[model samples]
Target: MNHAPASVWKNPVHFLAFGLGSGAVPKAPGTFGTLAAIPFFLLMQPLAWHWYALILVLSFVVGIYLCGKTSEDMGVHDHGGIVWDEFVGYWITMFFAPAGWLWICIGFVLFRFFDIIKPWPIGWVDKQVHGGLGIMLDDVLAGFMALACLQLLAYFF
Candidate 1:
């Protein structure tokens, strides 16, 4: 995807107020888009989980509106490029845990697993939900499921 623009017509940071513009990646956008949020999560690693969780909750609420609006502006439905949901969702799974590389990798694997598998309730939410909230909800739930599994693994090993 083309790099976000620099001037007024360019970067959504220039165009939109929040991170809405980052969701505009042109190809495998969601994945690349999600990559953008990694630094942020890494930075927040030292913060307490409750604080991080609050921020995430806020993001989830605001994300729906921004994601939906961005989708409309981009004229696409759940475009692969728009992956702020994945960023937040992945972080959700990593909550209350160490942010070391191995843990991060595990979180990523678990997140991808639940996100892709979309088993049971995750699948149900994905199908039933609509618009921006719908788009983000499935992922958040996936994150939760992933977190559960990861925690279980950590417990046994």
Candidate 2:
């Protein structure tokens, strides 16, 4: 069912940008990329908050390049199969989330909702931005929105 170009497999940058092949899925590639991010979140969960934040920042910076390069190679701006953005976005959403499956699931749903719905500034950025930063910023906004909701839920409930 994968319509992803063969370049996704042959190119290392494309492979990573494609969420380690998860983005190659024919359906809901973004969702699959976010799902692929879970194991990484689990590994990072044990780190102190500052360390996690550091990694998050680094990931975002690197993602800009990765997404940009892959998009260039593919001749498509923000291709659905290039999902490094989703991975970073999901990580942002899970930042400081409680250590439990329930919280993880909630964070995932909230992130997916915001990413998919593309409300307000998220939608605005999606339209206005271009290239790799464009590919990443919208998802970054979605992650922050989802994170806000997650934090509020954790605080009140």
Candidate 3:
């Protein structure tokens, strides 16, 4: 585990990218980062879909810079400690999901599964891409895949 210095948290970019310090938990940081996003997801759940989408887009755009900058500071590309991508990715996964804790838990599990498994292009991009874009893109794909599954489940059952 390539842990960032304590002072790294002083930087707002690092703080956010690290999922408000959840990424520093020393065990399953990505999982913890995704967990940290749940409250924010709930807060956004009541918004109009357009507003929710706008927020997701903005988060992704900002995350590119935030993740990149933090990675640079830590001198590790896509370091495990940089998990703002996971937060936004999980949020994206839950988009249009049905109400209730059951849906939320399902979305969470789907997002984590795709993210950790990194199938096909997700795995490819993770290996080939570089910098902030790389840090966020793979997770974005994972979220999209999970969202598709969630939406399908909602439609069928």
Candidate 4:
């Protein structure tokens, strides 16, 4: 029922923050945004783990600015539509994952589960932090949580 502002389309920062407009969906924007990230993940999957990690660091840094500035412009804190966090979080979940559709699907489901469920410290950070850092941190934690689970699955199966 929530509609994204026009600036989400007009502004580049907002566009990126909105996960390339995936966040503009009327429902489950976070889910859509996370889905949007899969292609980028595929593109990056060929890189060495260290290089992918570097990209993670860079994207996290930029996401802070993108999420913060877009939130300021929209005058809303952590709007559901600002889903750059979801994109980065999904990427983090898939880090060092094996190359296969099965892994991709598993990572996606795990990341979404952690992100939506917000267990433990992820939930704690979601409540305690504010601004861009806060916005990104909860998802970062979710990503790590999902990554841990995915890595374990890979190890055991």
lDDT of each: 0.72, 0.94, 0.93, 0.95
lDDT per residue as tens, model 1, 1-157: 4443333146452233123455455555555545566777898778977889888999898778766775666565555555768878888888876647888788787888888789989999888987788878998999899889889877886
- Candidate 4, residues 24-123, lDDT tens digits: the string is 9999999999999999999999999899999999999999999999999999999999999998999999999988999999999999999999999999
Residue 96 error, candidate 2, Å: 0.7
Error of 2 at 57 (Å): 0.8
> What are the TM-scores, per candidate, against the unseen true structure?
0.81, 0.97, 0.97, 0.98
User: Which candidate ranks first by TM-score, i.e. highest?
Assistant: 4
Ranking by lDDT: 4, 2, 3, 1
Which digits, one per residue and each the tens of the lDDT, describe model 3 over residues 16-110?
88989889887789999999999999999999999999999999999999999988888889989788999989999999999999999999999
- Model 4: weakest 10-residue lDDT segment is 1-10
lDDT of 2 by residue, 21-127 (tens): 99999999999999999999999999999999999999999899999999998888888888899999999999999889999999999999999999999999999
TM-score of 4: 0.98
The local lDDT score (0 to 100) that residue 51 gets in candidate 4 is 94
In terms of TM-score, which candidate is stronger, 1 or 3?
A: 3
Query: Clash number for model 1?
Result: 3
